[model samples]
Target: MEGALERSLRVFSGRGVLRTEYWDATIERFHLVSVPPDTAYQIGYTGTEPLWIGAWSSVGGDEITDESTLEPAARPEGNAEFDRIMATRSDRDLATSPGYDGEYDADPDEDRPEPVVTSFANTAAKLCPKAPEVGCNADRLAWIAELPELEWFSDSTVMKLDPGMYASTHTHFENEGPHEEIYWVMAGKARLITEYRDARLRRFDCAFFPTGNPHGIGNVGTETLWIGAWGARGGIEGDFDIANLDVADRPGQIEEYERVMAARKQRGLPLPPNADILDP
Candidate 1:
């Protein structure tokens, strides 16, 4: 018989969750640089219900191996440190924090439940600068994982892609994958192409790629692209191509790809372009 995690991944393999609202999302933006375009990082959680949803994989400095299927990294010993940093925050504050918006508890008069807080600061700190930009591209990026808070459902992180960069095409179906991928576009533009579907994405859009599927995202415009992504296990998987990716990837990446395309067509804009054929 299959184990619990395996059972769950099998159940959620084909699902895709896209952001439906903008103003209602709980998102916090940050940066490591002290200059303009400090828009280098963002973290948010929008859970896809029913499934024990969560994330990992695709873009990171390190290649996540199948071992991730064993389970999330052991919780590091920085809960106290993270608690101290967040101690000033109350349940009310958590209710209003990024990732909790539009998700208020049923009874406002009832005492709000405290959010489960997990810290990956230990791991994050370990990936810090080895010397001012000498051997450290990872440090420039913001990352959060070991989110015990999400019940090992997923690990979340952000990727900052510059214009013209073509993300390596890969499937995160190995263990930590089998994850239904989710992308929240915080800034800029890109073309997301799967073997069957392709779409042009822009600011505030979002995208969903099923586990085990092959896809490529390339920044096709002139600005930096900040994508907030997550992976959760559960849902239907298939080969049908989803058209009209602009609305979804930028903020409205949605289930109705055709509807989104119609509006774009009415506006005289071209259909989403093909994925970049960059030299590997």
Candidate 2:
């Protein structure tokens, strides 16, 4: 059997779409997603705080050949906090174990950057509960990437929507008709509805929303729905940025939410508490 580390390196080239699950020195709980075409990967992770993120991109959509001098290391260079965290890594961190055999070192010359933890725990922990508070329709949410650390994408994050919370029907930047986005149900179940389509998203099921589309997601399962969301090379992407959302046309969504609340009321169920704020 091929070792997990070797197998990951074998297919982790900067060409095409590559997906693998890794339990390295810096990663704890993890989930990744992305869009297609040029290639993208969104990862949700918890680990030592990192100072920079590394990723690969082709110079002109061809093979990644550029000044990307990033070498492959279990964690970013010069992160003492990360080193401390890894020292106490759980037994589940198999790749870092002494007996594991999978390993790959980047060719000293190619030095292509690879996909990183698109999401970070330190920042994720600081995000407001309402991912897009203004236009969203949900009352309760457990989201992970309000402000992710990446180069090509923005407003990308993951959320675990409990039964009572929902993603309000809205578009990216509202009237700004074009946005590319990805939503994947990593675990549990969810019901996603877009301007033109709606379906139940089960484990590993994903829905892609191209530009100029509207969509929303909510948990329809008994357990919390773990969702992985991402976007590609567009939108408001900066070191610490969140997209500007417009709520002018959100009354319709509010009306729809009222209906759900009414149903909860009819069944003698209280609406989930709506108070969520970033701490001061």
Candidate 3:
């Protein structure tokens, strides 16, 4: 049984399309599928308890143009901050954790750079200097300064808010397109209020704000909360360094707001009072 189980997860190197098989012990059969190049697949259960699989590919034509066959371009080496973060990481922390494994391309044509890594223990929290006047009542721990290879996203920060605190009411704007952003609750509850919608989010909950959407969030629960925010890069090149937000785009609310004050307002639209979190 152990040998069969080990073989079930084994991977081999090959070119062109790849095939994978899932062994369903309940029915004693294998579900086989082919994965095209430059495509990805995942298997999981739906909310209704039905098994499902999904496949996705990049937009445009079926084939993606390969990188130049000539010498690969020089990639950006680690900066001072990147070096410092790497220095603080211990070997044990970099090692693969138990109960997790993945297959990798053994050899590739293009030059691949080493991944930059860090932990919260190696970083410190600082007062968010961007929009104190806008009532963004939270401390920010930035991650983008040390990760330059992250080309698409401009800002990545883990924000911490105490109970009864409210974030800024502003829209992140980009000259070329609407600034897309995602907020994922890491440790607490959040009430995300935007121009068109207001949602209460719990741990593991995520919300996406499309371009031109003005939004603000608050710590609605009694305990301290933490949320991870990532926004698409746009506008002037140097603007990315700052939290390029149009604070005046919307009216500001109180510095701190209780859940009861927010509940009094209508639920469909953005809340006037700041507020959410999970327990149990």
Candidate 4:
């Protein structure tokens, strides 16, 4: 009987038949196979069929050879050379304080004449409508990123507004966005009149406004007024049509608006009618 059973098993095994069981932990499936090497076979359960096959390597293991791989520890000198080249090509070298180049510095000084002026009109000419008088203008040494040679961020223009012995009124509108505007009274005193208040901003003093806020500046002091304005959002359009506001015709209205603003300030409430005073 034993000899007969051994012969029977040998006959079945010789016909490319051997039984082995495998548990796939990932899929939670058990597989039983009787197949030759490199041969595919299908197994089914509950009307679902899945193929099973034998591979030379285990599944989900690294297929790449170690000999063909790049080892960071083995290429110290090559990495150093690459680092040196990257540092040479970087803009870090230009990121420093103002340096002297005959007349201008990389950075600007309040006491000195502006090193550079970037015009917004010139920049806007490439984009949309133009505003020559009250567009973007700044007198500062800047690093224009677009034109690396020019040394500012954008193609915006800069203007030098001077209150020479008398106060002058100018309308301004921004197209790009709100800017961190500052009125650095370099030589004389000035008053900045926005949609809100008529505050006295003196020389060397600075004031800031959120983007899209419409405002204007006038030299209220008896001297040459120099102010510096620069911001990433300075290229925005003005929210209100400043040209339409007839300051001469609305003097009485402005006085009443000012009185209301004073009361709002005293009560610590939100800015009242002054907030939307320029909507019309």
Best by TM-score: 3
Candidate 2 Cα outliers beyond 4 Å, as residue runs: 1-24, 31-115, 118-120, 125-137, 142-151, 173-178, 233-280
- The Cα local distance difference test for each model comes to 0.39, 0.42, 0.41, 0.30
Error of 3 at 45 (Å): 22
Tens digits of per-residue lDDT, candidate 2, 1-280, equal 1111100111111222222222232333332322222221223334334222222121212344222334323234423322332333332242233432333332222222334433234434322345343234554434444323333444455566676456655544333323466776766777775534446678767787765455677776778777766554443332322343223233344454455445546766434333121110
What is the lDDT for 249 in model 3? 31
Which is better, 1 or 2, measured by TM-score?
2
**Candidate 2: C-alpha lDDT:** 0.42
Q: Candidate 4, 97: how far from true, in Å?
A: 15
> Which stretches of candidate 1 lie above 4 Å from their native place?
1-27, 30-113, 116-142, 234-280
lDDT by residue for model 3 (135-242), tens: 465553333222243333444456677776776765555542345667777667777776545678887677777665566777888787777665554322433334
Candidate 2: 10-residue stretch with minimal lDDT = 1-10
Pick the winner on TM-score between candidates 2 and 4.
Answer: 2
Ranking by TM-score: 3, 2, 1, 4
Would you give me the overall lDDT of model 1?
0.39
lDDT of 4 by residue, 1-280 (tens): 0010000000100112121121111111111121221221112222233322111111112244342244533543434333332333232332111222223222321221111212222232111122212321222121111222121112221223433221122322243322333334434566565544566666446665554454555554545455444333322333432223332222233444455446546766344212222211
Which ranges in model 3 have alpha carbons more than 4 Å from their true place? 1-111, 129-146, 175-178, 234-240, 243-271, 274-280
Question: How does candidate 3 score on lDDT?
Answer: 0.41
Which rank order by lDDT, best down to worst? 2, 3, 1, 4
Report the poorest 10 consecutive residues by lDDT, candidate 3. 1-10
Please report the TM-score between candidate 3 and the true structure. Answer: 0.48
Model 2 vs truth, CA RMSD: 13.3
Give the TM-scores of the predictions, in the order they appear. Answer: 0.40, 0.47, 0.48, 0.29
The backbone clash count of each candidate, in order, is 22, 3, 3, 33
